[model samples]
Target: MKINTYIDHTILKATATVDDIKQLCKEAKEHHFYAVCVNGYYVALAESELMQTDIKIAAVVGFPLGATSSYIKVEEAKHCIDQGAHEIDMVLNVGLLKSGGYQKIIEEDIRAVKKAIGNNVLKVIFENCYLTTEEKKIACKLSLNAGADFIKTSTGFGTGGATLEDVQLMINEVHGSVKIKASGGIRDLNTAKQYIDLGVSRIGTSSGIQIVNPT
Candidate 1:
């Protein structure tokens, strides 16, 4: 399989700068990775840098924390799309999920963004590290119901990262209606392959080059 194409070459650190984003686009082009994932602020810059190339730009909304109001998240998604982000990786409202009985609010939140983006890809980040198995499954269902294109594993800013068990559970949970993206703590070729082998359609990592060329 073409592992490079499966990668969403990412840089979401709060300290990221213009030069850093330029370098990220540089590596993504050199590696021919599928996309360059950045925070909302850099979507336009990434779009400019990757303009002539086939590389897609994916941006994060509500970022590492999913506690933002739906209005704010929706506005952020819209702004990113306006700035040329081809896809959005949005954090699910984990607080609401854990709080329980906020299922409709959570689903509506996703739907609102989906509606705003309209046909652009939406990958719901479950941040599985903080969730129980059932909670993960519930998030998967909510994403699918809200018309998500992919179900993502983590924000990488969470206490933990992706695990095979979580990926497998998500796989079964979606039943192939939506695609899967495994992110966080995936730093090597073998690990990337393991997730790919298990049917993840995308790998979100900062170590794209290292995964392709370890030496």
Candidate 2:
């Protein structure tokens, strides 16, 4: 398979600079990656650098922690969209979801972000490292019901990243209605291929170059 096509070349570090974004865009173009995932601040820069190319720009919302209010996440998503982000990878309200008392709030938060982004792609990050199996399944259902286009595994900055078992459980719960993205810890060809082979529509990682040209 053309693995590059499945990759969302990413760099969401807090310390990422303008030069870093420029280099990311350049590498993505050279490798023909599916997209370049960046922080909200760099969405426009990446867009500018990637203009005239098919490479997409994905922005993260609510970041590693999903504790912020739904309104804030929605606004952040809208701002990113206005800045030319073609896709949004938003962190789910992990605290609320884990509490198990605010299930409706979690769903509404995702729905609000999805609504703000309109037809643009929306991927909800579950940050599975902080969730239980039941919580993960619940998160998948909530994201699907909230109109998310994809269900992502982690933020890559979380306590842990995506795992095969988690991906399998996500696929089982999503049932193809909503696509899956296995981010975090996917740093090599074999790992990326494993997730793709499991039917994930996208792979989010900072190792696109390594995976494509491991030698």
Candidate 3:
């Protein structure tokens, strides 16, 4: 398996600077990662740094907290695409999903962002650590129904990261309607391989270098 191709080399730190993004793009190009995932503000910088390479730039919307209005999320996604993001990883509204009010609202949230991004890849972050097993299933269904390209396991900022059990549950739930992205705690070759073995289409992590070339 080409593990590097499965990785979305990521740096979403709140304190990330332009230099950090430049270094990120450099490493991504050197390592031949599938993409570089960064915050929206730095998509243009990453684009400029990676324009010569085939590496895609993924931008985050709604980020660690998905409490923002759907309109805001749409705007964020549009702005990121405008700034040159080839893909978007959007946070699902944990509050709304937990509230159990109307599931359509959550679906609409994904749809709005997907619409804004057009053909760009859209991965919806479930932050599975905070959800129950049933909630996870519901989230998978909503994301698929809303046209998400991938269903992500976590935000890496959540209390817990991707787990084998969660990935399995998601795989069973989505049933290939959409691809899966296992993020968060994937920091080693073995762990990353484990998720890929479990059928994740992508691995989102800050440890791409470590996973591909461990000490």
Candidate 4:
């Protein structure tokens, strides 16, 4: 399989500079990656650099922490889309999901962002490291119900990253109604291959270079 086509070449560090985003965009174009996942601030810059290319731009909303208010996440998503981001990777409301009885609230949160983004893609990040099996399944359901285009595993800044079990669980839960993205800690070729083979539609990591060109 063509690995680059499955990669969302990412760089979401808080310390990421303008030059860093430019370089990331350059690499994405060079490698013909599916997309370059960046922070909201860099959406326009990445867009400018990636203009005329088929490569997509995915912006992270509410970042590693899903603690931001739903309103904020929606606005962030809107701004990113306006700045040329083609997709949004939004963190799920972990606290609300764990609180129980807030399923509707959580779903609405995702839906709000989905609404804001309109025809663009919306990926709801479950940050699975903080959830149980049931919670993960619930997250998948909620994302699907909320019109999310993809159910993502983790935010990569969490205590853990993607796992085969989580990806499998997501696959079984979504049942092809929605796509899956396994992010965080997926560094090497073998690991990326594992998730891809498991049926993930996307891979989010800063290690796409090493994965595609391992020395």
The parts of candidate 2 lying over 4 Å away from their true place are: none
Clashes of 3: 0
Query: Cα-based RMSD of the predictions, in order?
Result: 0.6, 0.7, 0.6, 0.7
Among residues 3 or more apart in sequence or in different chains, the pairs in candidate 3 whose N, CA or C atoms overlap within 3 Å are none
Report the lDDT tens digits of candidate 2 across residue range 48-155: 999999999999999989888888898999999999999999999898888887888889899999998899999999999999999998999999999999999999
Q: Which residue pairs show collisions in model 4?
A: none
For candidate 4, what is the lDDT?
A: 0.94
| Ranking of all predicted structures according to lDDT, beginning with the best and ending with the worst | 3, 1, 4, 2
lDDT of 1 at 206: 93
Candidate 1's C-alpha lDDT?
0.95
In candidate 1, the residue pairs with backbone N, CA or C atoms under 3 Å apart (3 or more residues apart, or in different chains) clash, namely none
- TM-score to native of every candidate shown: 0.99, 0.99, 0.99, 0.98
